[model samples]
Target: MIKTTVIALLTAASLAGVAAPAYASAFGDVSPEFRSFVADSIVADLNQKGVHATSVEEWGDLIRAYVTNDNGTQTMEFFTPGSLQPVTK
Candidate 1:
């Protein structure tokens, strides 16, 4: 009986994780595969430009990147979605 109870509790705990909601991106309505592809492209381009880019994501209709600077500081940079051009204020 004790073994059965322990197993039941463990199963429930594992199931709770599976039932949890996935983290949503800004463009959650769009397909995840497309978004991943775009983000990956942006990362690759930025790295090629020697930007030291860490990660990229879609944010509010723009592509946002986390970049590390030569001074060891991190900053957020915005870019156009398709062209991947830097967006300046």
Candidate 2:
């Protein structure tokens, strides 16, 4: 699980770099584009947490995603929206 999470973070960072050609660095007052990049990365991370997850929705500081479990749908929440840490409720 740790290995998967690490890979996810690295993948997100890579995607962000590709999304923005002018990406300077990973820290300090980054651009709005960088923030958006981070958000996208977070969403991807959430999607993988629940193997059946089909969609992701961002609400304020919480990140909500839907997954189709064996019986029905399950929702996953992440309290920290832009966190590199794994999905936290």
Error of 2 at 79 (Å): 4.1
What lDDT does model 2 reach?
A: 0.52
Kindly report which residue pairs in candidate 2 clash with one another. Answer: none
Q: How far out, in Å, is residue 16 in model 2? A: 6.1
Q: Across residues 20-57, which tens digit of lDDT does each residue of candidate 2 receive?
A: 33222222246677666654554555556544545544
All models: lDDT?
0.65, 0.52
Worst 10 residues of 2 by lDDT: 19-28
Candidate 1, residue 67: how far the Cα is off, in Å: 0.4
lDDT of 1 at 88: 96
Where model 2 places Cα greater than 4 Å from the true spot, the runs are 1-13, 16-43, 74-79, 84-89
For candidate 2, the per-residue lDDT at 56 reads 48
Per-model TM against the reference? 0.58, 0.38
Which regions of candidate 1 deviate over 4 angstroms? 1-30
lDDT leader: 1
